[model samples]
Target: MRGYQEDTPPSSISGDEIAGMDDEEAVFLGYLDEMDELVDDNMEEVTDQEEEDTDMEPPEDLSILVFNKHVGSVFCCDLHPSGKLAVTGGEDDKAFVWSVQTGQIVFECTGHKDSVIFVGFSFDGAYLATADMSGLIKVWKCNLDENQQEPWPIAFEYEAEDLTFGLWHFGARVLICGAVSGDIYVFKIPSGDIKVLQGHNTRVECAKMFKDGVRLVAGYDDGAVKVWDLKTNAVLQQIQANVHDMRVTAIDTHPENNIMASISSDGKVILATSSNGKVVGQLQAENDLETVAFAQDPQLGFFALGTLNGDVGIWDTARQMVRHQCTKSDDESVVGVTKMIWEKDHLITGCLDGAIRVYQGRSGEKVLQLTGHRSEVLDLCFNENENVILTTSDDGTARIYKYEINKDKD
Candidate 1:
């Protein structure tokens, strides 16, 4: 596992912090807690997630349909904006779709020969895209109402060695992707045209589109965060990458602020202003974080980070401290977490033990403990429209659960 980099006090910049947008560092000082390992490395990974054998059957506690046919480890799952269709990618070299209500495997799209590390649907839900470890990215258009074999039509396909995937840094639409050669490729959709932004000292880890996709913010393994102009494809701003000499695992943008949050393989969680390239706040974690998510509503004012230590920390980004800590008694580190939007009061988390636990965002109460995957739970998405949860497990399955949600009455 990589280690967290120690930080000096944040850069003192003026006229950048958005007013009434979020709390300042002084306010965050009160929220600091000792458990949040304040070490040198912010993104240190606790442990790497090992692929569970796909041959195992899902545990009965879960309520969704098992994907049932993939031969490799599933890495991620995402639901369409419509909430009826779902998609998953895994180590098995396949990406599958399922009915959110029926638990039936409606589509199993396969072609990539390597592990499918990430998968996503477009903002409008018109397209589905998947990225593999080998840097292969494929786009599929959905037409599930038609024949199953034709559930998705092949749209765009590219390889790392050939065109170099700039797989839409934020979504299938964003114009930034990481090159295997350690460069940032900023390109828009459909045209497949690209502008290669060279300068990262190491491999680019993640990139994001900002405000209507006109600007981009990105982080790399070398520890630098660069803000770029989409129109000109120029480096507008840059933050040095030495504070933490580790891999950047996850990064998220504050919907309303120019602020960006990044977690490293070294275990340091940091916030930087994309507009000016400055750090707003920082938190140290005990283990390397696998995933991190910001709340849809900043007033609920939260973000969740899953650690390799089998723990989940619910942080109040405003307060600058973890308000809640969730840990499995066993050594089951959490791999994925999502903040439920419609139900802003809750969060959904997936762990290596294949357990999908739903918890209250405030009280940290365990709301539901669901089981379905035979192996580890890789990804989770919530469909508030139907009150069901979509999850993909390492057992080669994606399942939907619709358990009742009854509020506790006195």
Candidate 2:
């Protein structure tokens, strides 16, 4: 309505003029521009909040370097616990293990026949798992020593036919993968024993370990969320029959509590108990959601949600309301937030705008913005101790950035 030409009416023009003056079709053409304006107006408010929001120490930029070994878009990446190593998998059907400091390729995994969609390191940093779009998963034993260029040999492999997601267990002894057919495969390391979790009616979109690795939480395309007992290899409870009006897009469990947060394509985030599958709280956004994550510190266990329309929200799960909307001060065009994580009092977001932004947790004041990727970032991993992050992008590169944090502050 704001951009419509209200002075010209349909009756004021001749037939030929009417065809050329049809403003209704022209109104639809400006939809994206309207969104850009609205988001820009929203984020403009954050500049005001910056006046009073000093809870977070300002972030410092240490480095921004790119890895260009992959010939195709990098789909996934993971940082080891030690913060010294990183792994990335990409569309080129190859996975690369690299040093986070120098961005040097440590080892190249080149056996997958299709695009590698997921790559993760075990909690102990002793193993790495790489999975392709075709459901072939390979586990490698990271043999890094003083050389740092040591070969990582393939220890085992599994095929699930339609792999969607995968991760290493907390102990680094279990490998779990979700399939397009709505089944989950749990592989015991070294032993090669497997357990299959079946309950979801369609594809499994996301899955996470909970209860100190005793249980697993999974979300599906049909909007169902389930918690499984890993020891028994059975679903323990159904967290939600319809967590969202549409497919579940992402999920994140609490750092210390038994609750987990789930988001769907319909723009809703639900916080529920993992043990009994009870709904505790919910938050809604104007745009469909892309990802959600909980902060690691239990005392400040706020959660963050990223939307498809490029908005970011920091919610107080205990209060059941958003504390800050990062885009409320939009000074530029918005882009979808594809990945996000919360560390202490800060939130790190990987945006489809091909930029990585760090915001103060409580006020949503952007502290730092890192730009290097030529396309949307597909994955992100942060190492709090080292103040480093590894990000993979659709532009066929994995990048490493070092953030300088104020250690003197509490």
Q: Indicate the TM-score of model 2.
A: 0.81
Query: Candidate 2 residues 241-308, lDDT tens each?
Result: 65566888888899875789988877777889877889988767655678888887888758888887
Candidate with best lDDT: 2
Per-model TM-score versus the true fold: 0.73, 0.81
What overall lDDT, based on C-alpha atoms, would model 2 receive against the true structure?
0.81
Give the poorly placed runs of model 1, Cα more than 4 Å off. Answer: 1-59, 103-105, 147-151, 162-176, 199-201, 327-343, 403-410
lDDT (0-100) at residue 373 of candidate 2?
Answer: 75
The collision pairs in model 2 are: 42-328, 42-329, 42-330, 43-328, 43-329, 43-330, 44-329, 44-330, 45-329, 46-329
Worst 10 residues of 2 by lDDT: 54-63
lDDT of each: 0.66, 0.81
Backbone Cα, N, C clashes tallied per candidate: 35, 10
